[model samples]
Every structure is written in structure tokens, then in C-alpha cells.
Target: MRKLWLPLLVVVMVWMVAGNGEARLRPDFYGSACSNVEGIVRQAVRRKLNQTVVTIPATLRLFFHDCFVQGCDASVMIASARDDAEKDASDNLSLAGDGFDTVIKAKQAVEAQCPGVVSCADILAIAARDVVVLSGGPNFTVELGRRDGLISRAALVAGRLPGPDFDLDRLVSLFRLNNLTARDMIALSGAHTVGFSHCSRFASRLYSFNSTTAVDPSLNAAYARALMRACPRDVDPTIAVNMDLYTPITFDNVYYKNLLDGEGLFTSDEVLFTDRRSRPTVERFASDQAAFFRAFSAAMVRLGRLGVKTGGQGEIRRDCTALNS
Candidate 1:
């Protein structure tokens, strides 16, 4: 584990120094343009979460989905004429509506105060950070100045985003493409501590995973039985199960602990603990909340930097649900 940490740290440092000539994001991005950008996003997220706790996880997942597909731009919020946008992607259908609604509401609030100044992408980055803090997680500094993407085709989503069934190597390869290390991937996944997964996403484990496998042998028997009740063979696809049954509303290390106990809801998640390369980080995070929070914060900042748009590349979308005209 000690040997691994050095390599991971070097990778992160290299990423920090590398750039592609686009406008770089910074913590003080809106210092002069929209002094209250962070406050506006925080207030809107708090109000939405106050209305429904689900928005915390929803917003977090929303940010992840958006970044993974088309950088940190707000392309995921765009609605297409023929339902061909990123949001319409089959894998994205389960994203909680509350997440989109919260961003829209926050964008509206930002526009009211600093119309046409803050980008929807920046709003999402800030909102994601705020929601985590509001949910009892670490309050890390979030860089801003990301622009909204103009192109959001559903065709680009399939292979770009990691799925709920990926193995360790596949997951590592995916995150590495975005400049994230294996430790970063495990830490970022800790967000599952507060989210909900639809029955359809994990139903295979309860019924039949494949032609030869009836259930995932890694899952705890008692937990599997409970999941079966929550997600029967014929259960509606829309029905959801808390990702972390122990502390679904809190943003702690309980999700990692659950994985340690074979209570991970997704195969993608459990594979982290089972795979030797990532298992140490998973175990460390499960036992040390501070470590998880630190890594998660750093990884999120890295995620926010993935394929960002800036320096006249994109626009400050007036309406998050549609591209700027």
C-alpha cells in the first residue's frame, strides 16, 4: 500500500500540471464576475434538499454522469427535440429527476443575480460540492469557469461512462482515461453512501445474473434476501433501494464499510474490495472516514477538471435544459 501511494500521488500531480490550452478552472473564478455564485448554488441546493433528502445523492450522481459523458459541462441538462440528448441515454434514464430539477432551480437563481455570467457547467460543479457538504461530507474548494457544452449526443454516452457491472481493470481503465488514479476511483465511489439504485440496475443479482449464475456469490446471504424482498423478480424497474442501508442519508465511509461486509449494492462497487489493486484503499477508507473524505474531495476536484470547456469553447447557457441560441 505504501508503494502504491507514491505512484498515485505522482499521477495526480502530473495531471495538475498538464493542460490542453483551454481556460483553466480556479477557486476564485467568479471572484469579480459573480461574487455570490457559490452562495447562490449552496442556498438553492439546501432548499431542494430540504424539500427532499434524495436530492443530495441525486445531485452528486448528476454531476458524475455529466462529467463522465461530456466533461463537466451541463450537457446532461439539455433536452433534445427527438429525445436524442445525453439525458435520454438508456443508462441515464434512472438518474433522479430531483437532481436535474435542483440544477435548473439553482441556475435560475444564479441568472436572477448574475444573468449570463455564470455557466451552467460551473453551477453544476459548485452545486455538487455544496450538496456533499450539506449532506455532512467534506466541504472542499470547487473550481469554477466551466462553460456549457453545445453538443450532447446520446451516441457518445454508451462507452464513455462506467456502468454498474464493470470489473476492476475496466473501471481503472475508464477512470485513468479521465486522469484519475485507482485510489481516486475508489474514493469517488464513496458517494454511493447516500444514493439510491433502481431495482433494475441490480435485479440480476437477486434473480439470475447469467445463464449459469443465479446470484452473485460475493453478496451477503442476509443482504441478498433483503434485496430480493425490496427488488423481487418482477419488481418495477423504477423502484429503488438505498445504496447504503446502514446510513443512506449520511455522506460517511459507511458505503466502504458496507463493501467490506459484502453489502455493496452494485457489482462495480464490490469489485473494488475484491480486486487486490484497489482493496487496500477500500479497506483504509472503510475504517478511516478522514482518509475517504480527503481522497473523495481530491478526486471530485479532478473529475470537475475532466475535458472542461473554457476560453470561448462553449457558452453560458441561459437555460440549462437547452443549448444557447
Candidate 2:
């Protein structure tokens, strides 16, 4: 009995020491430590970005629409209030254009307070959350420490970002290119639960057999009439617009429910339910708001990591609207 006890004790000691050595090999394993300057900078930047979003919800949505279309580049931020034609040409409305201005103002404030401490990418991320909140969605804290992009290529905008014409496959492919999974694709599209779109974007669905732009027949008749009124046939092709009339200011499972009922306004919105691969995720999100929020938050964290060049890889942009020119 004594000999057996000694061997067991020796084995326990070996196991304990080996476990400590393995833990040391892990890169993220650490003991309690003081938060660094980078941590403080991250917090400040997030706070400012969140505030900017609350102040300008429409702008945040526009910013997101522009960025997602083109590699998260900030070119869509460029606008001149005096030139309505120029603004419209770029698809920039007064509400969205002002939001861009607010982002710039917030960026300037952060520079004044932190001086090259926060990144444009981080600002965009936090601002997106604020947009969700203002639109009547859940507000969650975003992890920061992203650095600004030194370059903002306009050419990248047209081909990279998803548009009103894209189908489920195209949408999924774009998200995949950005490192987003199928789950992320469904969760992020839930954002549409709270915004509006131009009729020009979805008119093809109503008028043509183009599956990518076709409207669902199950939409509410009154809602359809309102959209048609706002976008009559004689209306200029560029002037037609449509709002996500239901839950336009709230973030919930209604978007998914709309899809379930064949009421999705955009083909992209409807494809989630139509596509074989994406259908399950859509149903899950539609059935559970809390689940949707959880997945959405996780996906956002992943999205914020896309193309992020941190530490020595990128510069902190003083102006979020323009490249470091």
C-alpha cells in the first residue's frame, strides 16, 4: 500500500508540472495585468463612434451600404451639401450625407482628444452599432484597437460590394470573400430589418423576370400601394425609392418573418428564405430574436476583423471621410 501511494504521488506531480508548461506555451494565457494605453485608446474610440451613430442613424446606414459594397472603403463619405446633383449621383441623400459629416466631426474630436490614437476602421465598427441602436435594435459593446486604412480606393467600390441586384449566391460569395460564414451572412442581413431602400434598387423585381430583383407577391397590398405612390412609373429611374416599411426603425426577427411570408422587399432579402443553403439560418433568426442578436454580435466581431491592418500595419486616419492624402 505504501509503495503504491508513492507512485501515485509522483504521477500527480508530473501531471501538474506538465499542465503549467502547456499553459505557458499558449499565446493568450496571462495573469492579471494592468490595461495598457492601447486599451484606453480603444475604449475612447468606441465611445466616440457609438455616440456619432446615435446622433446620425441614417448616415450610419448609408455608410454601411457604401462600405460593404466596396471593401469597407470610406469613399462614399465624400459629399457636398450644396450640390444636390452630385450627392444624388453618388446615391447620397441629405440624411445619409449628414451622417457622413457627423462621422468626420467625431473623427476630428477623437484626434483632438487622443491624437492619432484611434483607427478609422474602429470608428466605422462602433458607429455601425450605434446605427443599430438608433434604428431600435440592441446595443452591444464592440471590441476596438483597429487602425485606419491609409488608402481608400474608389475603383474597388463597384465590383466588391453587394448591390440590390445580387442573388443569394452572389451575396454569399461576397461575404465569403470578406471572411464571413453563412451564419454571418444571415445574421448581418438582419440589419435590413431596420432600414429603407430606393425603388430604383428593387423596381426590376416588380417589372421584370429578373429573379435577382423581383418582388414577392405576398407583400401587404397597402404597403405595396404606398411604395408605388412614392415611386410612380413616370418617376425618374433615379428617383424611385422604397423603405423597409415594416420594422424600419426596429431590429427584430420581422425581417426573417417577412421572408417567410414572401414579403421581402429586395431580392437579396428574399433569397435568404429561397436559397437552400441559407434557409435554415433565416428560419432560426426569424424564430428567435435573442438568438439572432447573439449571432449578430458574434458576426459583427468577425466582420470588424476583415481587412484590418493593425499595430504597425496601418495608420490612424485623422479624417474618416478621406484617405490619408
Candidate 3:
């Protein structure tokens, strides 16, 4: 009876946390306060997308980084004079300028119609989905009503994000700590379908990969050669490459197919297919675009719900780059 009681209590706690977040974040959360919220954001996002193709991956990556570090609160948007904000962190420094620009533009447009009624966090969430749809990916409703967090510290970002070299077990454990499962991790990884990674991030896999091999054996021979040409050791390591080689700019299920063909850019990505535990999911998503779309949408919703500060827990920052004074 004692053991059973503990398990039951844990289950109840998990259910309450998940249920409470969903209740607070609704699709029509701004229906009354800001009736044209989605439309305003869509226009702003479209404008940004038109100006630069980087908008698609940058904004999508921004949302992921924001949610992972600060629980979808847009705390990552804060800019500090002392260079100590979350965005100043090494993991976040690579986030492109276009992402910040997209959210800021949307926030400005939102404030024009409904001043102080919308949070930067919600705008970011909406903009993320908008970019995905604009980039030829799945269109899913984004839950709104998340408030911007006041705290943004560079010190808080370490180990919060998944790395390029993480193995399947490490990746699964990291996601699990955030109340996510292996399936969720794999599905979320599909975002790489339209993502980019810098050369330095995966240089080791291409050159000097231990004494056993020159290049990672998991990489397709032809793919490795392509990567080497694109990211020569003597050249700048900051040069960026698309995560999906086939559809470099589009957001689709090609990411999973790349994994099946050993073209996954990062070990963290290819591990999804190499590990027997997660290979089946990788294969399923690779073959069925509809299945991948459904799973991705569901995973994104779950990812957005992590550590959310809804209701009175957080504030609606007037300036996304700084907490309201």
C-alpha cells in the first residue's frame, strides 16, 4: 500500500501540472483582448519572411531555444548591457538576427492594435508556427497566453539545450527531465528539416574522428565528402550549412530520410536512426509525411507547454529585449 500510494501521488502531480498548463494556454486566448492577434502576427511574419529566407529557420530555432531554456516565456529575448543575458550564452549566440527581428516586428505590430494586451512570449509562439507553415511544413494551431518571464541570465542556460554530439541515451534523458519522451525528442528533432548548423559544431565528425576512423562511419561516404568540401578545416568554422541537404530551405520529412541514408548532419540526429530503440520511429517518419507532420505538431505543443508561466506568474514585457521597468 505504501509503494502504490507513492506511485499514485506522482501520477496525480504530473497530471495536474500538464492539465493546468493546457487549461491556461488556449488557441483563442486572445480572442477578446486582441481579436486580430493571429492576423497581425501573420502579416508581420510574412513581411519578415519576404525580406529574408533565413526567417523560417531562425524563428523556429528561436522558439525552440526560448522554450527549452526559459519555458516558452521569451526570456531569451532580453538583451543586457553587460553581456550577461540568456541570449549572450554560447549556445544561444548562434541564433540568427532574423529570429529576434521577426518577434520584435510582430510585437511592435501587436502593440499597435492592442497595446499591452499581448505578451512577447505568445507572439513568438504564433510566429514560430507561422514560419513553419510559410516554409512548407505542417500548419498547427499554437496555444497562446504565455507571459514573458522577467529573468534572463546567461548563467542559467548551460546544459539546458541539447548538443550536436549527444547520444541517444543522453538525448532521451535530457528530454525526459523536461517531462518529454523519446518519441517527443525524435519528433522535435524533425525541426532540423529546415534548420542549419555551423561548421565548428560538427567538424570533428568530418576530420580526426578518433584513431578508429577518419570520419564517422555512420555518415554516408558521399555525404561526408560533400560536408568536407562545404566545411574545409582551413576555412571559417562559422560558415553555416543546412540540416537537410535535399530540401535545404523547406521544412518537411526529408530530415528523417536523411537519417535513414546516414546523411544526418549531427550525431544527435543520426543517433535517432542508429539506435534500435528509436530507429523504428525514425523510419516511420521517413516514409510517411503525414505521420511525421502529425507527430511534429503534437511534439511542438508538448514542448511549448514546458514550465509555462501563465496567468499572474509572469509579466507582458513592453520591450522584448528588456524586462519592463
Q: Pick the TM-score winner.
A: 3
lDDT of 3 by residue, 1-325 (tens): 0111111110000000122455689899988999999999999999999998788888988988888886888988999999999999988888888999999999999999899989998999899999999989899988988888888999989999999999999999888877788999999899899867788788899998889887999998878887887778875655667777667678889899889888888999999999999999999999999998999898888888877888888899998898998
Sort every candidate by TM-score, greatest first.
3, 1, 2
Which 10 consecutive residues of model 1 have the lowest summed lDDT?
7-16
- Weakest lDDT window of 10 consecutive positions for candidate 3: 7-16
Superior by lDDT: candidate 1 or candidate 2: 1
Q: Per-residue lDDT tens digits of candidate 2, residues 96-164?
A: 444554456556665665666665555566566665655556767665554554544334344555666
Give me candidate 3's TM-score against the actual structure: 0.93
Which lDDT tens digits does candidate 1 get at residues 1-325? 1111111110000001113423478889889989988999899999999998878888888899998886888889999999999989987877778889999999999999999999988888888998899989998999877888899988878888888899999988898888889888899989999877777778887788888878898887777777877777886655677888866788999898888888888999999998888899999998899999999999998888878888888899999999877
**lDDT of model 1 at residue 274?**
84
Q: Candidate 3, which segments miss by more than 4 Å at Cα? A: 1-20
All candidates in order of lDDT, best leading: 3, 1, 2
